[model samples]
Target: MAAPPLLHRHFSNSLSSPPLHRHFTSSLSFPSPSMRPAALEPNLFISPKPSLNLSKTFASVSFENQRRKPTSFAPASHASDSEPESRENRVGEAREAVAEYLQKYGASREEANCVSSNCPSYLSMLIDGVDDLDGWNSLAAAAENVEFKRKVSQMAEQKGDKGVLPFLESIGLSLASASRLARYFSPSKSNALPRLIHKIQARRGGLHLLGSENASFGYLIESFPRLLVLPLESCVKPIVLFLEVVGVPKECIRNIILLFPPVLTYDIDTDIKPRLRSFEKIGVKDTDLGKMLVKYPWILSASILENLEKILDFFDEEKVPRSCSSQAIKSWPHILGCSVSKMKLIVEELSKMDIKSKKLGHVIATSPQLLLRKPQELLQVVSFFKELGMDEDAIARTLGRCPEIFAANIDKTLDKKLEFLSNIGISKANIPRVVRKYPELFVCDVDRALLPRMRYLIEIGLSKKDVGFMVRRFSPLLGYSVDEVLRPKLEFLVKTMGRPVRDVVDYPRYFSYSLEKKIKPRYWVLKSRNIDFSLKEMLGKNDEEFADVYIGDGEVLVPPS
Candidate 1:
C-alpha cells in the first residue's frame, strides 16, 4: 500500500524525528520536504551570501514598519481580505476551530461530528483556545444536565463496551459515579432487601450505597457492622450468605436482627415449614426462633399458631413422620417462654380448645412461670442438667427415690434439694418427681430449692384428680401408709376445697370450727334442694352472717355474748 497521509505529521515528526526525516530525504530526493520555506521558489536558495544578507536587512525593516502600523487604518482598503463575519459566521468559525482542535487530539472525524451535531454551542466553546483539562472540567460542571449525560452515554455506546469506563472517567466519574449509574438504572425492588443483599455480596464495597434515609437499604447494610449505617435488611442476607459461603462464626452476627417476616406462618403442610426447616439445616436454632419471636411479638399471630397446628397435623398424617407432635409440643415451651403477654395469650387461646392439645396447653401453662423466673435461674437449671448429661429416664428414676418432697409442704421442701440438684446436675423438671417420691427430703421450710418445685407444680395446673394422686404418692414419705394418707376427710378436703391439711393445722381451733360451720349450710343446700321450708327460712335469716363469715361482705352477728 502507498504511504498513508500524514494527518498528525507534526506530532509524528516530534515522536520519530531522526528516522522519518532520513527516510523522507532518501525516498523523495528532498533536502527537507516538511521544512521547505513557506511560498518560496527553488531559485531563492541560489542567491549569493551578500545579496541574501541585503534581502534579510530589507525584510527586517519591512517587518518593523508593518508592526508599527495600526490594523484599523487598512480596514476599508483590504475589503476582500477582511471577512465580514456575522454572529452565525463567528459561530461557524468557532465550530471549525473546535473540530480542528479535536482532530489534533486523535478524535476521529465521525466522533467530532457526533459531538458537534449534538451540542454545537458546547463544542464551539470547548475548542475556543480551551485546553483538554479545561474543556473536560467545563463538561463536568454540566455533567448533571440530563441532556449532557445522555449525549456522553450515546458517544460511549457508539465506541462500544471498552469505551464506557474511559468515557465516564474522562467526564470525572469515579467508582461512585458508576454505582450511582447502576442504582439509577436498576431501581431497587419494592422490598429492596433481597436486591441490596445481592449487590453487597457481589461487590466488595457495594454496601456503601446504602443510606440512612433509605432505611430498607440501610437495614441490609447494617448487617455488616464494620460498614456503618447500612440498612439491617440489606446487610442481613449478605451476612447470612457470608456466614454460609465463608463459614463465618455465628458469634460474629450477634448484633444483627434475624427477622422472620410476619407473613411466614409455620404450617408444615404449607411452604413455611419447609422454609423454616431449611433455615434450621443451615444452623438456625430454636434459640434463634425464640429470639425472633421475642423481638417481633406480632409475628405470633393466630395464623402462625394455626400453621403450627397444621404442622402437627402433618406429622400426625405422615406414616414415617419426620416430626412427632409431642416433639413439636416440646418446642412450643421455648416460644411461649418468651414473655408474659405472649404466654397469657397462648394459654387463653389453647384453653378454649377441646382437641388433643395437651402439649400446647402444657406449654402455655408452664410458660408464665418460666418467663417470670429470672433468666439466670433458668440458665442455671439448664446448665446443671446439661452438665450432668444424664438421660431423662435416668433422672426420672433418681427422682422416684424422693417422695416426701411431694407432700403438703412440697413447695417448701424443694429449697433443700437445690444443693443436691446442683451437685448431681439434675434438671428442674426432675425435681418434682424427687419431691413426690422422697417427701422426707422436703422436711426443710420453703426456700430457694422448694420454690422451683412449687412453681413447677403450679405451672402444671393439674386437675383435682391428678393433684390428689400426686399428693397421695407423698403419704409414705410423710410417715403414713398410702391408705391412711388417702383418708376420706383428707381426700374430701383436697378434692372439694383444693386445700391441703397444712392450712387447717395452722388455723386456730375456733376459727376453723366457725368456717366449717359457716360453709356447711351452703354446701348442704347446693347438694340437696329437698331440705324443708323451715330449714330454708332459717338459712335465709342467717344469710347476712353467712356472707360476713364466708364472703367477707357484712358484719358477723354475735348474740348474748
Candidate 2:
C-alpha cells in the first residue's frame, strides 16, 4: 500500500487573513505556559530585568568563583579551548571509519559468493552448463527457486505479465510456459489474439496459417482485418497461426489487401462465340455487360462476351419480368447465385429499364451467378448496337422507349434479330420503322444500320438518333435513299473559267428569268482579239514598247502582233 501524501506546516507572525490564521492554528501544537520562562530565556531575550542585573551579578561572583573553581576547571577549559577540527576533515575521518568497518565485516564471504553467483557472466555460464541433462536440471532448479519466483512475480507486477511471454519464447520455452503467461496476462482467456481469430473465421470462412517468412505475417494481417493492433512484424508466425484458427466468412469480406504483386492470366475459350448467340435467352443484359467493361476494363474481349451468353440465358429463363415485389427480387440470388455487389449493380441497371422489364431487374438482383454472366452479355449487346451504328445512349433510349419488348420471350427474339441484322448489315435509319412495324420482329431482325454520319450530326449538338430518324422520314420527299440523303457533304476544289457561282440556280434570278423569256441554255464565253498594229508604232520608231498579259493559271497568253 502507498503512504498518504505528507502535509506541510507554515508559521507566520502576521495573520491579517482569517483563513490563513485558522489554517496555522489547526496545523500547529504550541507549548503550554508551564513549560515557559526557563533560566535560558533571560540570556536569550534582552528584557529590561535581565539586562540591569547582568553586570552587577557578573562582577560580584566573578573573582571568588574564578579562584574557587580555577584548578578544578583548568583541564576541562584547556580541552574546550583547543582548536576545532574542520567539517571536511571530520567527514573524511567518518568515511574512513565506515570504509574500515565495511572492509572488515559489512560484506561477509557468503554475501560475496551470492553476488558472484548471480553475476551476468556466471549466470550465462550456468545457463550454458545446463544444456543437455545438466541444463535441464538447472532450468528446473531455476523454475522451482523461491527467489527466482519472487523476482519473476515482482517483474510481472511492475510490467504486465505479458512481459514474460517474450522472455519465455526467447528461451524456447514449452507450451506450458505460453499457457501460463497467457493465463497470467489475461485470466479470462478473452484476449485480442483469440478474438481476432474468431472474427476472421466468422467473416472469411477460412483460416490462414502463418508462414516462416515475414511476408507470411503481412498476409495474415491483411487477411484478418481485426488483428491490426499487434506488432505484427515481430512475431508474424504466431499471429498468422492465431488467424488460421479463426475463420473468415465470405459475406463479410469486402476487399482483400495484398502484400505481393498480383499476376493475372487469361484463357480464351474458342467455343464461347456460338454460345453467346443465345445470351438474351440466358438473361444477360447490355447494361450488365457495359458495367463489366467498366469494372475490369481490360477483360473487355469479344470472346468473353460470347461465353457470357450462356449465363445470360439461364437468368432469362428464371427471371420473372412482371413482379416488382421485394420477395421476387430477393429470390433472384437463389436462382442466379452471385455476390451482393454484382447482384446490386445488375439490379440497378435493370431497374433503369421500363417497368415492363422489372422482372429482369428482380431476377438480376436475386441471382449473383446471373449477374456475373450478365456483364459479358451486356458488353456483347452494346457491341452489337455499336456495330449497327447505335451509341450506348441511343440503345438505352430505344430500350427505354419500348419497355414491353424486354419480356423473356421478346428478349430472346430481340437478341436473335439483332444478331441477324448485324450479320446482314442493317442501318440504324431503318430500326425505328422496323421496331414499330414489326415489334414482333424483335425476335428475328434486331440488327440496325450503322449510321456513322449521324455521329457527326450529334457532335455538332444534334441528337444522333433524332437526326437519323428525321433523315429516314424525309427520304421519300428528298427523292433519294435515306443513306444518300443523310450522307454528310465532302469538301473539294474546282477551277472555273469565270467568277465563282455564289449560289447554284438562285431561285429569285431563275424565277425572274423564266418570266421574261423562253427557257434556253444560257452560256457565258470569253473571246480574245488580236490587233496587227504594233506597240512600237504607238511609241514611235526606235522607241520599242512591250505589253504583257497573265492568265489565272499562271500562264502568259499574249497575242503576237
Candidate 3:
C-alpha cells in the first residue's frame, strides 16, 4: 500500500536471482521469476524499503551489513548439475525432463510445453538444483486449503487456450515468473481459467480490503503468485481479519503482508496468536502490537520464540528486568530475533568499554536497536567520542542519551551532523559540547530539520556567531520546528515582549518553554506587576518558585484567557 519496493520484476532477468520472494540483497537484489518458488521456502523475511525504511540513517548500517542470512532450511536452489553443455543443454533431454517435471507437478502437457518453449532455461534451472516435488509441495502448503491438490489437477488440464497465462501477463508478472507460476499453481503453479477468475475475485474482495489494487497487489502477487486461488476464508481472510481483530487498522494490513508475505503462511491459532502473545506477555499493550508488527512484520514470520526466550534469558542474566527488554523490543522488534551469542558479543564489548553490566538492560531498553549493531559499530561511536575528548563515562552518557549514535558510522550521521554544525559556525572544539547538551542532535536531519532552524535564528537578527554559541549552549534549538516553535517564539520575544533578539543569544532555552502555557502567562504576570525579568530568570524558575519570588503567594492574577 505504501509504494512497492523493487517489486522484484528483476526476478526474471537472472537465473541466480532469488525469484519474487527472497530478501533484498546488499544491492537490493530481488528474486528473479525462476527463483520465486524456491525462494518462498527458507527465506521467510523480506526487508522491503518502501514501508520499513524506518530510518536507515538512524546510524550507520553499512548496507552490506543489512543483508540478513536468508534463513535457509532447505538445500540451496542454485542449479549445479553442470554437464558439458555448460549445465547448458543437451538439446532434447533437458526440455523433456523439464516438461515432464512440470506435468508431474500438475502443469498440463500443453501448458508445460508452452512454458518450456518460452522459458526453457527457467524450467531447466529447476531440475538439477532443487528437489522439485518437495519444493512444489511447500508451495502447495502455502495455499493452505483442503481443495489445493484438486485445484492443481484441474489447472493442469487447462488447454493452452484456456490457461491463466494471459491474466498473468496482464498483471505484469515477468515472463519467467508467469511461465513458472503457470504450472506451479496447485493453486500455486497452474494457469486454469478458474485461477484467473479466483484472482479477480480476490482482487475485488480480499485484496480490495487491503486498500490498493494497482500498487500493493502487484507486489503481493509477485511474492506468492499462488495466493490467487487460496481459500479466501481459511487462507487469506483469517490473516487479514486477524490483524484487524488484533487492532491493526484495515488500511495497514497490506503493509504487514507486503513486507513479509509469509505472514500469510503462518497459522492463526498456533503461529500468529502465539507470537502475538509472546509480545503481549512482555507488556506490549494490545493497541501497540499492531504498530510493532507493522514496523517489523518479521516478528510473526521468523522463528522468533526460541530466540526471544534466549534474549529474555540474556536480559535476566544481565540483571535487567523482563519489563526493560519489553520496552526495548517495542522500539526495535527485530531484536527479538537476535541470537544471544551475538548479543553476548555486544555485551562483552560494552563491558570492555567500562559500561557496567547493571546498566546494560536500561541502555538497551533506551535504544533496543543497539543490540543489533556490531560491537565494532558501537566502538566506532566510542572511538569517535574518545577522539573528541569524552572519557568512558562521558561516552556512555552521550551514547546512552542517544544510543542511535552508537552505530552511526563516522562517514554518515555523526560526521554529517558535525559538518552541518560547522557550516552553521559551530567550531570543532565546541561540537562535543553541543552533542553533550543534546545528543539527539546527532540524529536530526542536517538539511531538513537542523539547518532550517539555525537559518531561521540567524535570519531573525542573531549573528551566525551568536547562534554558534547558543547552539553550543542549547543545541536542541536546532531540532525544534520552525513554523511551530521557532518563528512564533522569536516573534514574541522581540515584537511582543519588547526584548532584544540578542537576549535569546544569552538564553536559547527560551525556545524550550511553551509559548501560551508558560511564556505568555508568566510574562503577563510579571508585566501586570510592573516587574522586568531576564529570559532565563523569568522562564527558568519552577512555578511555585517563580510565584513566590515574583507574584505574591496569595495573589490571584488571571494572566490571559
Q: Each candidate's TM vs. the true structure? A: 0.20, 0.18, 0.64
Best by TM-score: 3
Worst ten-residue run, lDDT, model 1?
1-10
> Over the stretch 308-425, how does candidate 3's per-residue lDDT look in tens digits?
6777878788778777787888877767656677788888887765555557766887877778777778777788888877778778777656777786668877888777788778
Please estimate how well model 1 matches the true structure, expressed as its whole-model Cα lDDT.
0.33
Model 1 lDDT per residue over 1-561, tens place: 111112112122211111111112212122234323232222222212121122211222222223122212111121336565533444454445444433333344543333233333243323332323224756656643533223433333332222212212222222223222222212222322122222333322332222112222222221111222223355444434433333323533332222222121123235433444433532446555544433322223443343444433433443213333333334332232133333344234323332124443233223323322343443344334344454444433332332122122212334444554444344555555544455354454434433443344344353333333433333222233223322433444457645555432222121212224443445455345443332223234466755464446585533311
lDDT of each: 0.33, 0.30, 0.61
Q: Give the RMSD in angstroms, all C-alphas superposed, for model 2.
A: 37.8
Question: Which sequence of candidate numbers ranks them by TM-score, best first?
Answer: 3, 1, 2
lDDT of 2 at 202: 26
lDDT of 2 at 104: 31
Kindly report which residue stretches of model 2 are placed more than 4 angstroms away from their true locations once superposed.
1-323, 326-336, 348-372, 391-394, 397-428, 436-440, 444-561
lDDT of 1 at 192: 26
